[model samples]
Target: METQIAFAFDSAQVANRFLNALKSSGIDNLKAKLFRGSEKVIVSYCYEDKGFDQTAATLDDLASRYDGCEISIR
Candidate 1:
């Protein structure tokens, strides 16, 4: 399965930090990209069912850490 996440930030630095954090969270098969024009970061992951709950928990931690940014999942 695939999960996609997108969030916008007011500054590029913050966006980059968020992207890095996701990468370091130990979530498997994750990929991330940033769109400069929109100051948005998009992340996607494809993996088996085992890591889904952990991924969601990691995301929740990130949401708290980057409280100033806007995040959405699809």
Candidate 2:
């Protein structure tokens, strides 16, 4: 049961900040892979979850922690 969360941030700094927060939260089986576009930073992570509810909760938690940071989950 691997879950993936992809985040779009305004800049690399925001991406790094999000990464740090995710790491600090002690989330298990979490992976953040980065992609660079012309004007945006993409971060994708894979986690183990049985349902999207748990994953959404985690995503929301990070979104709240980051405040202005933009995030997406799938």
Candidate 3:
């Protein structure tokens, strides 16, 4: 299974913070990219046997922790 999460923030600093939080979550199957101009971070994950709900929950938690951050999952 594969999941892609796009995070948009008010500033680059906030976006970097969110990216750090995602990396520290210890999800091994994830990849992240930062788009400075748009102040967004894109995270892509590939899991062998996991459901999307778990990923969504994790992302939701991260968003709650970071102010001015919005997430869209695809």
Candidate 4:
């Protein structure tokens, strides 16, 4: 099964940094994309169920570092 997480960050710059940090962690079978809004950037992440916990934790850690970052699982 595949799991998905959607969330928002303060800005596209923050979103980019988040994605870069995520990719740098070297997780496999991961996919992510970002959508820009006037004020906030929305990010959608998808990965295998096997890696869901680790990926979610990584996202939580990364999100904490940025302002107005929050994860909304769907």
Candidate 5:
């Protein structure tokens, strides 16, 4: 299954850093490209049966790295 991930930051500064991280590192083997919204970064991830677990771990790491960033997965 494919999971939808949403990342919203408190400021553009934080958002930029998050974007840079996403660009610099590969988020596992996600097949989708990340696109930025006016205030958030959104991407779709498909990882068979481990979608939610990997998504959660990824979000947790990102949230810990960037204090002002908010993340949601579906």
Candidate 6:
């Protein structure tokens, strides 16, 4: 039951921060594909069952920390 998670950020810096957090969170088999554009950062990951909960929490924290940064979990 792997879930697809995508988080789009407002900037590369925020994206980097989020990537760091994800890495530090100990989620195995994670990947940060393309960090394109100065205003958009897209990160995608495959999780083994109900991992969206963790991703959502982290995204919420990121949103709170960085103002104007949009985090989309889908």
Each model's C-alpha lDDT?
Answer: 0.70, 0.57, 0.72, 0.61, 0.61, 0.55
Q: Residue by residue across 1-74, what tens digits does model 3's lDDT show? A: 67777778778888888888888897777888785455788878775573444775677678667764545543
Q: Write the per-residue lDDT of candidate 4 for residues 1-74, one digit (tens) a residue.
A: 56666657777787777777767767666676674453343444455556436666776676677654554543
- Tell me the RMSD of model 1 versus the true structure: 2.9
Clashes of each: 0, 0, 0, 0, 0, 0
Q: What does the lDDT come to for candidate 2?
A: 0.57
TM-score ranking from best candidate downward:
3, 1, 4, 5, 2, 6
Which of the numbered candidates is closest to the native, going by highest TM-score?
A: 3
User: Which has the better lDDT: candidate 3, or candidate 5?
Assistant: 3
Candidate 1 lDDT over 1-74, as tens digits, reads 88776777767787778888887887778788885444677767764576445665566568458753446543
The CA root-mean-square deviation of candidate 5, after full C-alpha superposition on the true structure, stands at: 3.6
Give the winner by lDDT: 2 or 6. Answer: 2
Compared with the true structure, model 5 gives a TM-score of: 0.61
Can you write out model 2's per-residue Cα lDDT over 3-40, one digit (the tens) per residue? 55456666667767777777777766566656454223
Stretches of model 5 off by over 4 angstroms after superposition: 31-37, 50-52, 69-74
Per-residue CA lDDT of model 5 for 24-67, tens digit only, reads 65676553333465456665667567334666467557755876
Model 6, stretches more than 4 Å misplaced?
Answer: 35-38, 49-74
RMSD to the hidden true structure, all candidates: 2.9, 3.8, 2.8, 3.5, 3.6, 3.9
lDDT of 2 at 70: 45
Candidate 5 — which pairs collide? none
Sliding window of 10 residues with minimal summed lDDT for model 3: 65-74
